[model samples]
Target: MDAAFIHDNLEIKFLILYIAARVSRPIPVEGMQELTLCDSGIDYFSFSQCLNDLVRTEHLTLSDDGLYAITPKGLRNSEICESSLPMSVRLLTDRNVAAYNQMLLRKEQVRAQVTPRKNGTYTVTLHFSDDVDELLHLELMAATRDLAQGLADRFQKNPEQFYTRLMDTLFPKE
Candidate 1:
């Protein structure tokens, strides 16, 4: 209705497109929300609406796996209108995107889980994997949930050490 309202709406849509174009990867909705809504102070409802509108208008594509990627139309639009966005906002988006990328890499390489057993114990599973194969998969039983969680946390923090120690114990060199 008003000029300011229209400008804000257009900027929000452009910001979404700018982020998707810059990331150059399929980003989950939660990741986008983290960057736009949580980190950048964009209204959650507005962000969601813009995302849906982008997809509906074919500016962005949403995969069945729930990741969003910018379409060619979105990329072209962002390239043309990105200067309207403030440099500060662009820098903040870049930082958040880098952090999100690091988080994703860490998630892919290491994993831990704690499961409670019916026998009043817990099972802690620690896993380390690469793109093609699993490098390590260790399971330990702990008497208490705290202990189980602690083990899981330690494993996640330093899976390489655990894997090395396991190898050393299993095959001592002469």
Candidate 2:
């Protein structure tokens, strides 16, 4: 992945889509939103928009449930674009599971906190402190840059609407 591929983009949607693909699950809005809060502010909407860009490039598919899943092409892209991305982990803990369930009860209120997407679902909203966003932004930029550069080298065309596919892959907003 070339850094330049993502340098032109300031969004973190690609990261979300890739994560979702690895998990092979329909990522809820809140789940994706959580990713942005990890270091910066990569919110669900932005991520979803990036997936949309990927979809435009025929890299992903949008399901009726409003969750974006990886297509065969997306999986291949994941392999080809592997070098430019970062690795994430999946954890399972009984205590954590209990805690997450407890959080779900307050989901509505949590979603309400975000100004723009108050009407949107929390499954797609991410919340974090100020410091986290700053750190995450830099980390995401580095990773995305690599993915973009790698993609540039692999694809015959520059992929004009990469961001849109990224968004579709993340949210399938429509």
Candidate 3:
């Protein structure tokens, strides 16, 4: 790989702050790791220390669930100094942040739950939605808890495709 556009700790901190401020919601450490490591100049150790420093300084917050979010101070600083970052780096950051935000939106839109029944079977309730409307709601019975969880997990991964398949099965084209 070629050299990174950013080569200093302050810039690395700015890059981190920039990404966090642009994210749609609080993200786990893994998500932050993915966004911050896009540059060759940043190593895991430096990223780790910079992240902890931001938390200690109250520029970012670590939720009880281990999600990271930009605080008011962080956003203000990012807005003021983000232009100091190279245009190419900022563009790449924007592109990456946009893609991650889309995935976060999709995860928010699809949901599933598995519940156990005293009758020894499990029930899976599923919901699928678009940006503004609920497209489908259904309850299914599974023979086992594991099966129920698997069903829910698969649906959550790609609810649109599952719904389309169900519609095709129920009402095939003539």
Candidate 4:
């Protein structure tokens, strides 16, 4: 309804630092943008300038893959000044970061690969993992590329369900 609680470039930089510090892992520029641009005051141009400034100042690091992460310097400053951001903004950021981090973790845990076979069949390989263990890895044959891709897509969407259903099907109650 109103402009961002962030009033100026200083606040924008602080917000950037706050997000970089809070994220679970290094995030691409698009991810950073999603986290940092919630405020009306933080526009794309200003956000870009502040992000680049953080990199230039070594407050943050930009990887060759275009991911952004907080440096030690950035974290220290964020720890010191994060209290200055509005409580609402901080809470909102926390939620955004948590959701994005969960997505990242899921991406790391669930994986699917589709490969073409010489016989014109496709192989769909699915892997499901958790923090501690590989839950499952299964390979199945598909008649075509589309079928292989569809299976992979569905497996990624809910690997846990797929794994559970497969286990149940393999050993049903008598």
Candidate 5:
């Protein structure tokens, strides 16, 4: 209705497109919400609506895996309208997207393996490694494949937390 309200709404939509454009890989909805809503103070409902609108308008595509990526039209729109956004907002978006991408890379590097054993059991091996060396390698036997897969999924989600808890449990200080 009012000029300021319309401008703010456009800015938010543009900001979302800008982020999707800058990232190398598709960003999941939760990641986008975490960055925009939690880190940038955008209202959760507004942010979700903006994302949905972008998808509906063909500015963004929601992938089969549920990740959002900017379309060609969205990229063009960002290139043209990005200068209208505040410098502070632009800088914050860039930094947050970079950090989010780095986290995704780290998650990808963490490996999980599920193996079916001859004894009608499953073996789940969790590994956390970097460029040089393997930081952790743990194996657990599961009575069912579902259990093994669940452990693998959980480990992949937050290996650092899992490692820290394991260390704290095993080497409790006196």
Candidate 6:
């Protein structure tokens, strides 16, 4: 939760993992930056530096084909940080891929059948399976909107507090 941790370097790292987890593919740097951001303004030097730092620090692993994925260390660290707050946080790995894919498929199927409201927002319907805890299709927009709620919770409780704690954990800003 460190604001500094949310800086360009960390954001890029998270974005990489998020994209990899979602696509379930080992994404190249070019594709990752291009697809996930509005602009690939991050310089190659800086991006490679971040990637190297994370890899050297054991946060990510890169394939011979230039595909990148989170390391066990990275995944564990992210889960620990996410578990600090209540959110839709979950572990991403091969074991969870099947369930995640099924859920994603259901979400897509529901989205196709919905009509948008006057505000141009559509409701996502959910078809439940015994495996999932909830039976609700989450539209992309709705899911993004709800993304901030967890962040807001941290802010209300003093945004800097968690950041400070994270800073101590990561950089130990003494």
Candidate 6: 10-residue stretch with minimal lDDT: 85-94
For each candidate, what is the lDDT? 0.83, 0.43, 0.90, 0.92, 0.82, 0.49
- Listed per model in order, the count of residue pairs whose N, CA or C atoms clash below 3 Å is 0, 37, 0, 0, 0, 0
Q: What is the lDDT of candidate 3?
A: 0.90
- TM-scores for the candidates: 0.70, 0.38, 0.88, 0.93, 0.66, 0.36
Q: List, residue by residue over 1-174, the lDDT tens digit for candidate 4.
A: 165788788898998999999888999999999898988988899999999999999999999988998999999999999998888889888999999999999998999999999999999999899899998988999999999999999989888788888899999978
Better of 2 and 3 by TM-score: 3
Candidate 1 regions with alpha-carbon error over 4 angstroms: 1-7, 38-41, 113-125, 130-134, 138-153, 167-174
Tens digits of lDDT, candidate 3, 80-129 = 98998888888888999999999888876788989888999999999888
**Which candidate number would show the highest TM-score if scored against the true structure?**
4
**Relative to the unseen true structure, what is the C-alpha lDDT of residue 115 in candidate 3, on a scale of 0 to 100?**
87
Which tens-of-lDDT digit does each residue in 130-168 have in candidate 6? 244533323333333244344333333443354456557
Write down the TM-score for model 5: 0.66
* lDDT, candidate 2, 2-119, per-residue tens: 1222322232544544454555255455654454234333444555577677667776666677655667877776666555544431121223334444554333222212122243
Candidate 4 ranges beyond 4 A from true positions: 1-3, 118-120
Q: Cα deviation in Å at residue 106, candidate 3? A: 0.7
Cα-lDDT of candidate 6: 0.49
lDDT of 1 by residue, 1-174 (tens): 111222366788888888898774699998888777533346778789999999999999999999999999999999998888777777777888888878888788899999999999999988898778899887889999999999999888988888889899999998
- Global lDDT of model 5: 0.82
Indicate the residue-level lDDT of 164 in model 1: 89
Pairs that clash in candidate 5:
none
